[model samples]
Target: METAVIKTPIGYAEFKGDEQGLAAVKVLDTATVTVIPTVLQEAANQVLAYFEGSRTTFDLKLNPQGTAFQKKVWQALLKIPYGTTTSYLELSKTLGDVKAIRAVAAANGKNPLWIVVPCHRVIGSNGELTGYAGGLSRKKWLLDHESPVKQGKLF
Candidate 1:
């Protein structure tokens, strides 16, 4: 599998995949990877555009490997509109679990597709930001960047 690492405003991201599609996008705060290739140029561009608020959706093909429950959770996460927040309970209910809140949360955390899957949009029941593997501050920045309020203010 080919791999590349790029630095974003929020953090450094490692992109790995092959001819099939993107396999992983691991965020790291430091430079750890040896060689950063230029493969999947479009995907990298799209990621930059997303951070710049110039793109609201992604078009790259992905092949995130996860369990069935994690896949289901990640798929549902993609349906959340940009700039909006949903609770873990809400996600659980949407997935027809309603009682699988913790399980859903765990799956959400395991999502290999970051910003694209939008697990950052899921929050605690009290409307507070919850644990984000990418870091809470970065999560806040992403949410703020995509917020309709911020967009409206820019106009």
Candidate 2:
């Protein structure tokens, strides 16, 4: 399980695995790795493409570790379209348990795949941004970046 930690404009990101695939990508402020494999190269490239808005979906493979509920939330997160958002309530109902909003939100916070899984696209029922582990500011920036048309004053 070789890993590479690199500094990006957003923050320090540690990528594990090789160009054949990626296992996980962790966002950190500081970290060190003893070794890095070749697959992390492709992971880094794919992530860069995502930030550049050139990629809508990841082509790399991943084997992230999480609880079953967390995995389900992450899988649903992937279904959310780029530049769009879904409410926690919507996610709960869609998952066949409308009462699981809190559980859904918890899983969303635990999303280790970050931008790839797109936890940032989940919002409050009233359409307000909320509960982004990366912080609301970063979430807003990511959404604005992906928007097909920037919000503007109609005069």
Candidate 3:
């Protein structure tokens, strides 16, 4: 696996992958100083575009490592609209097992693709921000960034 780190408004983002496909994307306290492979550079560019609000969707090949159930949960996450939020309970219901809320949350937490997979879009059942591996503040930033009601300028 090859790794490259790029700076973002939130923090440094590390992308891991090779010629095959992108495997992981994680926010880090510090940036990595290494030559970025072509594939990784493309991923880095996409991430930067996302933060800039110019890109609303990602189209890179992903290879996140996880169990079948976890992959299923992450795949469902991708279907969530860019500006919408869903609760763990909603996710479980979407998966055809409302009783599996906890398991669904666990799988959501383990998603390796970060913004690409969009696990941060999931909230608590009461519409509260919950656990986010990248920190709640970043999650808030991401949600706000994707808010459809953009602020209009006053003349």
Candidate 4:
């Protein structure tokens, strides 16, 4: 798989994929060399646009690797609109099994694609920010970034 690391406001983000589609997008602890490939440049650009608040939705080919159930959960995550949040219980209900809340949350936590899959949009039933592979601060930042209330322009 081809990989590229690009700088973002929160931190560096690494994108991995090939001609078929993007397999993963991860946030790194530190900045790395920007070696973006031609095939993945569009994905990189879309991520940049997201951070800039110029693009609310992504239009890139995705090929996230996961189990069948995980894939189903991830696909449901895509339905979450920008600037809105959903609880694990709500997500579970949407999946047709409120009893599977834990399983749905597990799949969400295991999502391989980061911002693209929008796992950050999932929250606790009490409206609290929950576990995030990228850290709570990053998750909060993502939510605030997408918030309709404009505190100020994010450059």
Candidate 5:
């Protein structure tokens, strides 16, 4: 799989994938740019556009590697609208199993596509930010980035 890194307002985005499609898109504290392969360039551009506030949805050929259950949870995450949020219980109900809240949270954490898959949209039952593989600060940044109200813009 080809790999590349690009800077973003929040951090450096590390992309990994090939002809099969993007397998992972992780954020790193620091990294330098590398030549993005032909296959990964379009996705990279779309990601940059998203961070720039020009794009709200992604349309890449995704090939995230995960279990069937995990994939199902990710599909639900995709359905979450750009500026909306959902809770684990709500997601579990959506998946047809309120009892699977823990399991659903597990699958949400394992989402490898980061912003491309939007695991950050999930929150605690009480409307609080919760566990995020990328950390809560980044999650807040993402949520704020998607917020439609633009009373402030900090660059």
Candidate 6:
């Protein structure tokens, strides 16, 4: 897989995959990259646009690798609106099994597409921010970035 490590507002993100589509887009503490493969340029631009608040949704071709259940969880996550959040239990129920909360959370945790899949939108049942592989602070940053109200914007 071709790889591109680019710096973002929260941290460095390593984007992986080629023309087949984006396989992964995970944050890293540090990294240096000299080239961004041609296929990933659009993904990179979309990510930057997201941080810039000029884009509310992603439209890239994704190819995240995971088990069937995990893929299902990720797909559900994509349905989460940009400024909205959902609880693990809600996701579990959506999958037709309220008892699958833990399993759903586990699959959510394994989401490989980062912001593209929006795993960060899943919060605790009581509205508290919960598990985020990219770190809670970064999760908070992303949520804040997507917030509807801002100091200057009317909408």
lDDT of candidate model 2 versus the reference = 0.81
What global local distance difference test value does model 5 have?
A: 0.95
- TM-score between model 1 and native: 0.91
Which pairs of residues clash in candidate 3, taking residues 3 or more apart in a chain or in different chains? none
Candidate number with the higher lDDT (4 or 6): 4
**Clashing residue pairs, candidate 5?**
none
Ranked by lDDT, the better of candidates 1 and 2 is 1
* Model 4 regions more than 4 Å off: 152-155
lDDT of 1 by residue, 38-113 (tens): 5667677888899877999888888889888888998899899888899999999999989999999999888887
Give the clashing residue pairs of candidate 4, or none: none
Poorest 10 consecutive residues of model 3 by lDDT?
A: 29-38
Q: Model 3, 1-155: lDDT tens per residue?
A: 99998888888888999888999999987776567788798898888899988999999999989999999999999999999999999999999999999999999999999899999999998999999999999999999899999778898
TM-score of 4: 0.96
Q: What is the C-alpha RMSD of each candidate to the true structure, in Å?
A: 2.8, 3.1, 1.8, 2.3, 1.9, 2.6
Quantify all predictions' global Cα lDDT against the true fold.
0.85, 0.81, 0.92, 0.95, 0.95, 0.92
- TM-scores for all candidates: the values are 0.91, 0.86, 0.94, 0.96, 0.96, 0.95
Clashes of 2: 3
For residue 114, give model 1's deviation from the true position in Å.
1.5
- Worst 10 contiguous positions by lDDT, candidate 2: 30-39
**Which candidate, 1 or 4, would have the higher lDDT against the true structure?**
4
Model 5 clash tally, residue pairs: 0
- Name model 1 segments beyond 4 Å from true: 32-39, 151-155
Instruction: Mark the regions of model 6 whose C-alpha exceeds 4 Å error after superposition.
Output: 151-155
